[model samples]
Target: MSTSITIFDTTLRDGTQGEGISLSADDKLKIAKKLDDLGVHFIEGGIPGSNNKDIEFFRRVQSLGLRAKISAFGSTRRKHSLAEQDENLQRMLAAGVPAATLVGKAWDFHVHTALQTTLEENLAMIGDSIAYLKRKGLEVVFDAEHFFDGYKHNPEYAAAVLSRAREAGADWLVMCDTNGGTLPGEVHEIVSAVGLALPGAPLGVHTHNDCELAVANTLAAVQAGARHIQGTVNGYGERCGNANLCSLLPTLQLKMNYTCIPHESMAQLTNTARYVSEIANVNMPVNQPYVGSAAFAHKGGIHVSAILRDSRTYEHIEPEKVGNKQRVLVSELAGQSNVLSKAQQIGLHLDPSSEQARKIIDRIKELEHQGYQFEGADASLELLLREATGEIDELFTFESFKMLVEKTAGGSVVSEAFVKLNVAGESLYTAAEGNGPVNALDNALRKALIPYFPSLRDMHLSDYKVRVLDEQDQTAAKVRVLIESRDYRTAWSTVGVSGNVIEASWEALVDSMRYALLGLHSPQPVRTEFGQRGLVNH
Candidate 1:
């Protein structure tokens, strides 16, 4: 029989504390619903009394009938105030959540300095807060804030905090590494000691990533008998960030033989991480553990070939187990398999040993040498393959383009662009003005092509990234531009590079629109239509 670990996701509460991430009440509810569907045991919704958004979030989420227990988060009652009379405690109760997590100072330093209270006063507050919340019919999880560092400083005092929570009838006592500086050995030692001290109470662990050891410290705590694991998806939080449940859950279930969420639903981990990021409007970390875009991505030829033979040679776990897929990046270092796989994804079939495949690989390498990275620009890579195989019709070609940028006194900068296109044995010239040279050029190009391809109206730039490849000379330097575009449901990225920023942008912009058009016009056999016609004839 295996022990079951409770996954308490604080992404909505703590993850949103990360700088530049501000989720409204509605966004919090939406993400909370997603986490509940992802099967987390507890959802730390927000600090209920902190702001209106959080207060409203609790109200909105109550109607969701979520499977996971929603926990309102707040600190313990103030030093001089009675637990029942404390405004913060009252707010948690008024939120109407079934559970609440209340944090109290476990560190003697914080007790004496930060809270301006003695160690004895802190203990009383912790006990009284938990007792009050428990009496209110809310499951109270006592967060022993800064417990690890406190244990190191005063072992007896830290254990006393756990003993206090146990006596107060708290549902679970979560030991927190607030500063996130504790090592795994220290974590194992402290959790072992605390477990012995409060054997009657359920033990939980909350760690931060200050030393990049949040995940390690969390797992060590589990091995030492702590059952509940509290963290955010993707390890998002203030400072160095919280422990990452994304990495911890998989390790515990697969490696340590602990029961986490259901094995079948574990596949939702990667998408869940991205879904949260999308709602928060934060760019997902491409290299984050378990769920990142580059988590299982193979770029080197040696590694790619090895993974193709046996994924176990390079990968620690099957990507599909965590709802992620292995990606073979087509680059200058890519092999024949990489090219073939990429071509197959775009519905293109090519003989791997043939001249066309060789040409495509050579062109990729050549473009990479010129600062075009295909890994981030798959749309451009696909267009290159089509053009190299003569699958693309040269319906129109660029003859020349020029952009003029001028700044006027006490006014905004003005840009005018002229574009020339050679199409159907005739020349179409267009001009447009915009806020910037790139914008002007884009407007002129779109104006010229909109008549021919009406689908251009559906296309728009999603993201644009510009990186200077050579930083030695600021004035004359090579730059790389990555452009992400979308046409309704489909999105694609393209890359361009040159010493001239406008030219690089133009190259990527053209490829982005071409990819969108290709997706819209590409034919697909309709099985439903064929089946209907067959039934009618019969």
Candidate 2:
């Protein structure tokens, strides 16, 4: 068995089988570049003649200049057809890619029943398809579709199909757990047999997550001598999804000592997973192994205190090894270390024993007990910590504001808001209209601040979320608004809670602006009864 493995990512092909996962040709090319930069060996671009979008992807990827070979996926010729004259094979050659992966029926159930073909004819089809592709001088990878189930029922026929592809000059005999029912022990056992059956031929495994063991099964195959690993980013695929490369690659390189992705590029694993999730419009699984936001997050007070002295106290490995950070999740359940660690991350050197730090932690606990969660609102936490020390400058103050709504002749309602701010004790007022009440308030607030703080022009709200604190009160319940804002460089989150929805939104928006202004000035850290947090431009 080879020591180094090939990383084959099928995000553009099998990954699109997932519901709600779709990508344009341009999106496909961009992701392919990211995968190449991460040092993956092969990328399955998609079947050329399957869809117009896939056809366009082939055309666009031709100029990508990637290190990874872009393989086009298709199937063997129909039963009883000449391989040279096969339409599918003809398109595969026309794709002009370096590699071709063709999946054929290795299961007798699919052959004798689905295609209604005899066992002998199916073997002939597999051999002819591979031989024809080899004659065209293309690198061929034979995917033994349903190989595991086939071996369980008709072991002889399953072994025969793989041998036929090998004899016909297929470069790789890829065993696929199409139904994903096979366990890891079974995968290891079968891949070992397949390796012996086709001596001198390279082996590979493709798996699904129907049993929630795609990653385990893929690793098991690698343990049993498979060299090329097939998977998708964040495990995005049909049904439960394919083997997750985010989890698999790290396991192979860091644990098993198998060489896959380059050691230096491993740090990019988190960003790569997040990039694909964003383009696919999928939420990042917070607890996903290695790359998730909460993978290395410490929340318990006991765990936080120990991790402050030694990160290995609760962590298995340094999170930075995978482009992730050790996060001290501050909540009502936190202790002094949570406060000190969070402050340290934002460039604050706080004296944990001091009154200001204790006051900040106490207030955070009180607010969270009242249903204000701060895990996603660390910028708000920073503002509170600085404010408690009297170190934060008051950039703006509320004087008075009014909101108005007007109904047009077309049955559309328009909202207008006017905001009054006391800037340097001078009254400044502005009015603006928007698609909704929150938007109008945001516009009016920015207008009022631009004259005094023009840097607010470069900042804008990126995301807004609302949660009801007391659902029993229904419309009268206090609503918590969390707003994420970004300037030209980085982003931050702030939160607020109030019984009135508009008022809650206004509070969060104001804090977001204040944090941005504070970050811009980067005021010096000062010492008092407690140490202060430095504003290092966030």
C-alpha lDDT of all candidate models, in order: 0.85, 0.87
Lowest lDDT sum, 10 consecutive residues, model 1, at: 529-538
Candidate 2 residues 58-120, lDDT tens each? 888989899899999989888988998999999999999999999999899999788899888
Best by lDDT: 2
Error of 2 at 234 (Å): 0.7
Deviation (Å) of 115 in candidate 2:
2.4
lDDT of 1 by residue, 1-538 (tens): 9889988999988888878889998888888888887889999988877889987898888799999999999999888789989989998999998999989889898898899988899999999999998888999888999999899999999889989988998889999999899999999998998877776569999999999999999999999999999999888899989999889988999889999888777898887888888788888888988899889998887887787689898899999999888887999889988888777767788998899899889989998998999998878888888888777766667899878788889988999988887655556677888768877877887776666566788888878899999899696999999998877665679999999999999999878777766744432222233241111111
TM-score of each: 0.89, 0.92
Tell me the lDDT of model 2 at 529: 31
